[model samples]
Target chain A: MIGRLNHVAIAVPDLDEGIRLYRDVLGAHVSEPQDEPDHGVRVVFVELPNTKIELLYPLGENSPIRSFLEKNTAGGIHHVCYEVEDILAARDRLIAQGARILGTGEPKNGAHGKPVLFLHPKDFNGTLVELEQI
Target chain B: MIGRLNHVAIAVPDLDEGIRLYRDVLGAHVSEPQDEPDHGVRVVFVELPNTKIELLYPLGENSPIRSFLEKNTAGGIHHVCYEVEDILAARDRLIAQGARILGTGEPKNGAHGKPVLFLHPKDFNGTLVELEQI
Candidate 1:
């Protein structure tokens, strides 16, 4: 089962602009940009009191975010992450309930250096749901 | 400034089905369905330990969720809501920083009976951002 709301990710065309918007304008504490090659994204975290905002930009032409941006042009909310106490348990429970997991159906290292898995958007009402181990 | 993440809203084609998925399958506590005529949608809240998930369905032909579902038949994430300590101050700050407020540029009563304002998706990397006064 989901534990807590981890973070909401937003895909942006430009990482610096997104950082500036959240930092200077929104007064959020933003971390240095980091390249998540495995995920094929350049990301930065905007820290909030109770949660964080992840700014994601495509790292390559084949990156999924690139295709999302191609259709949206302006980028958009990529996914919502929820924390779980146990990754395998959560995955099994979801699978038994007939939820499809993305990417080999195994947990991968997420931005926070924790195990994470993405659920099919169709199963989650059109929104991609990310489950991360706490 | 944003205080905390209040909830994530997902637009669903069927409200009852969505409730079943979260409540029966995911084992979440779900609130009774409520018709929010002002927002032109019927909604239910899935209670989580840290935050809530709002399932939205079109209430009428002109409802915005109707168009969203037309594009994404399976439904999807609608918007992200963040709590603000002061709605007016947050609006003024965001507006001053070039973020366009949606609707009438004034706070309106939101689902939880709190003042809320929406920021343009274009300004926040295409993610519709909702600010609610807590």
Candidate 2:
């Protein structure tokens, strides 16, 4: 049911600064950033050899990214995304097993246009879990 | 500078229950558990084809895992560790760049006896980052 790791989600205070650090300093290459209006965040994808790094910044007060930044406890790791063979089926299984789904029923296009969904951290312990279907 | 993902660490209250869920239900294979008295926790490793899952339970009050579970906030993900070429060099680079180190300067034996060190989450943001040298 699980594929290779697709990407690692990271929450940062400043998208530009994060991009600079990951790209210029860390030597990671990123694709042009895209914004998700519905999710209320602008994100960039720093594609790595085996996995990708996603940098997220809030676009509005209602955005969860904003809340995440406000907490500002650590700007480090946000979520681990496992590539899945079937996202819809996986989401259903998780829901049936009592995992709370964060987004609407539909999976939306994420940083790289891949369909993605988030499992509520409350349900999965403290770690925010994201599932991306390849 | 890195190998395939080694394992993902998770903190849970009941080591037995967590083991059952990941092993019996998730169909992951696990190695016999070992106890780390110094770290104050007992741990089990569930080995997957592409990755490994670590289940940690506190053995003493001083264990960080114990405090993590006491929060009872979630029964989910803990930290994401990336395989690295040189953990010592990586540690020094992160330190020089202002990242805090969690363990003593020496690399300790982790679940599989691999050398590993944790970068303070406060320094890297909220994410608990671990680097394991292959």
Candidate 3:
């Protein structure tokens, strides 16, 4: 079952601008951008009192969010990550409920080095969901 | 200026189906549907451990999210609400920084009965940001 609202990922066309918007303009505590080539993203963490806002930009040519950025252009909310206990069990439950898992239907090393899986946006009110193991 | 992430608003095409996805499928604590006819929205709150996910659907003929739902079809992240200490001060600062605020540049009563202001998506990395006075 979903626990905490881990983070809301926003895909920005420009990472520096995204950082400035959240850091300088909004005055939130923001982390420096870190490139995660494995995940094909350059991410910055905007820490809030209750949760985090992840600013993501495509890293490589075939970055996972490249097409998303292309369609969104300026930027957009990429996905919402929720914390879950026993991700494998959660995946099975989601499957039993006829929910679709994205990718190869296996958990992968997420941006936080935690096991994470993507759920189809169509099955989630058109909102892309990421379930991260706590 | 931005504090806790108050909530993430998702504009869903179907309110009951949205509730079922979060409550029945995802197993999150869900609230009963509350119709804010004044705001032209029917809302359901998914209470997460850290924050809340607001499931929004059009309530009246001229619902604000009606156009958004038309574009998104299945539903999508409508906006991210952030808590602010002093909304007027935040508005002035945002204006000074060349940011555009939606509406008549005055804070209005939000769904939570707090003064809130919406920023233009174009100036916010394509993210519609709502700043609610806490």
Candidate 4:
């Protein structure tokens, strides 16, 4: 089962502009961009009181969010990650309930170095959901 | 300045189905549907630990999110509401920074009976942002 709302990831076309918007305009404490080559994206954390807003930018040509950025050139919310206690149990339960797991149904190391699994958007009311094991 | 993320509103085509998915499948504590005619939408709140996930459905003929539900069919993230200490001050500061406020540029009574203002998505990295005065 989902534990906590981890972070909402927004794929931005321009990373600096996104940072400036959140930092200068929104007046939020923002972290410097960290490159995650394994995840194929650059991420900045906008730390709020209760949760985080992750600003995501494509790192390379093969970045997974590249197409999403292309479609929404100004940037848009890409997905929301929820913290889970036991990922494999959660995955199995979701699978038993006829939910579809994306990307070979295997847990991948997320940007936070935690095991994560993505559920199919269609099964989740068109919202792409990521489950991060905490 | 923004404080906690109040809730992320997801516009769903079917409110009942959305409730089932979150409550039955994802296993979150979902509230009963509450109709807000003033806001032109009915909402169900999924109470997570830190924040809430609001599932929205069109209420009547002039429902604001009717077109969005039609476009997304399955459902999609409509907007994210962030809490602010003083909304008028926040609005004025956002305007000074060249951020466009949606609608008549005045705070309206949001579904939760709080004064809320919506910023133009184009001005905010294509993410619809709502600022509710806490």
Candidate 5:
């Protein structure tokens, strides 16, 4: 099942603004922004003592974050990630229990360079949940 | 600023259904349901290795969660709570940095029996963030 709270992702309209809020204002250690073309996002990680916060911005026109931003003008909390020891086992268990996996039903390389899969928001009480292998 | 991820709150239409999904399906350890009249919401905690998941449901007609569910019939992620070392210090720092605290500027007793304050969604890139003093 789920292991740790890997990171909470917040989609921001402007990556620079998001960085300023967390870095300059909040005074948190933030990583360099990296383009995740596969996920259609530009991401930066704000490291914390026990968990991390991921700042996400749209990378391409068809980016899902862009659509989310359109619905929410200021952008918002996009997803919460939970770590799992075994990705396939967790996926199978969740599937057996009638949870819908997003995309191709296969794990992909996530922002942390680990295998990850996204569960449909409808199945998770309208919150997009990401399961990452750690 | 932020110490750890306290919990991710998800507003659900039905508390029982939410529990079933996380407990029975996800195989997570869930706490007993508790009605928080002060917040006008019923809450339950799903314990994980790293962080907890809070399942929230409207306790009364006037509950804010009720309004959220009206828009999202399927229920969804409500807010993310981050732990802080000192609530007052965190509040002062954030306020000085132009972050608006939700409700009153003062902190209130949170679910985990800690002083907590909520930041406006607009300031945090549309994420309703909760900062709890640990």
Candidate 6:
């Protein structure tokens, strides 16, 4: 089921550079970037009504974003996240319907400190998608 | 500047099947799908605030969506389209900032019959983005 458009995730090679680009060009206010050591990512948020623009940069060598960058020739968009009312319910429904879960069983804190889960790209047609519950 | 998120474009193998899945599961209202012969696409829009979820299916062999589908092994998300007040101004700015334009020079009618242009993925990093003017 389609829910609210959560946040659009953009993978950038350099977090600070990307932040400056968006802020200066788009006049978007950049939130403090958070480093998620567990996820191997550093993210900054530009909040909007019912949505956000998430700037993601790899935090470590093993970061999945790094691999995505390597394989993906362009990096303007990484994923489209949808916000669901219930994370667990959404996850179960998606999995039952042939979607593959990429993250662990539990929902992890995302950039906005909301519970989040990522679906495998293979499961979503070709797009890497994330689901978030505030 | 980034106007509003006009719509999120998702490339699907089958438009009818995708519409059913989104409507039945997500409770989204499916708008009358439009066929753009020039673009070789049939698109159905599910509207929301400042955004729409666009389900795109190829209309012919030369369809760019078809090539995207072929190159992309997965089938989930495609590109994120942002709304801009002035398509021409935005296009010029992006080009001045080293971003490449993908579509024809002139703005063409998009799914919603709005003026639209596509920026090369190389400009923003790796995300394929579309800009629409309402």
Per-residue CA lDDT of model 5 for B20-68, tens digit only, reads 9888877789999999888889999999888889999998778877888
Question: Which residue pairs overlap in candidate 2's backbone?
Answer: A74-B125, A74-B126, A75-B125, A75-B126, A76-B125, A76-B126, A77-B127, A125-B74, A125-B75, A125-B76
Model 6 vs. true fold: TM: 0.86
* Docking category of candidate 5: medium
Clashing pairs in 1: A125-B75, A125-B76, A126-B75, A126-B76
Worst 10 residues of 3 chain A by lDDT: A15-24
The deviation in Å at residue B53 for candidate 1 is 1.3
* TM-score of predicted chain A against the true chain A, for each candidate: 0.94, 0.82, 0.98, 0.98, 0.95, 0.83
DockQ (C-alpha) of model 5? 0.80
- Candidate 1 Cα misplacement greater than 4 A, ranges: none
lDDT of 6 by residue, B4-121 (tens): 6767888888677777656654556788888888888898987654467888888977887888878754455678777778989887877777667785767888766789888776
Which numbered prediction scores highest in DockQ against the true structure?
3
Q: What TM-score, over all chains together, does every model reach?
A: 0.93, 0.79, 0.99, 0.99, 0.95, 0.86
Q: For residues A1-134, what per-residue lDDT tens digits would candidate 1 score against the true structure?
A: 67677888888998889998888877778999999888889999888777788999999767878888888788888898988899999899999989899989989998789999999988888888899999
Q: Which stretches of candidate 5 lie over 4 Å from their true place?
A: none
Best by lDDT: 3
True contacts kept of each: 0.77, 0.28, 0.86, 0.82, 0.86, 0.47
| iRMSD for each candidate structure, in the order shown | 1.4, 3.4, 0.6, 0.7, 1.2, 2.8
| DockQ of structure 3 | 0.91
Q: Which ten residues in a row have the lowest lDDT in candidate 4 chain A?
A: A1-10
lDDT of 2 by residue, B1-134 (tens): 43445667888777777776555533357677779887787889866546666878888778877666766545556677777788888777766666677868678886557888886765554667677888
**Candidate 1, residue A122: lDDT:** 83
* Model 5 residue B12 distance off true place after TM-score fit, in angstroms: 0.7
Model 4, span A33-67: residue lDDT tens: 99999989999999999999999999988999999
TM-score of 4: 0.99
lDDT of each: 0.87, 0.70, 0.95, 0.93, 0.88, 0.76
Q: Compared with the real two-chain complex, what DockQ does model 4 have?
A: 0.87
Backbone clash count for every predicted candidate, in the order shown:
4, 10, 0, 0, 1, 20
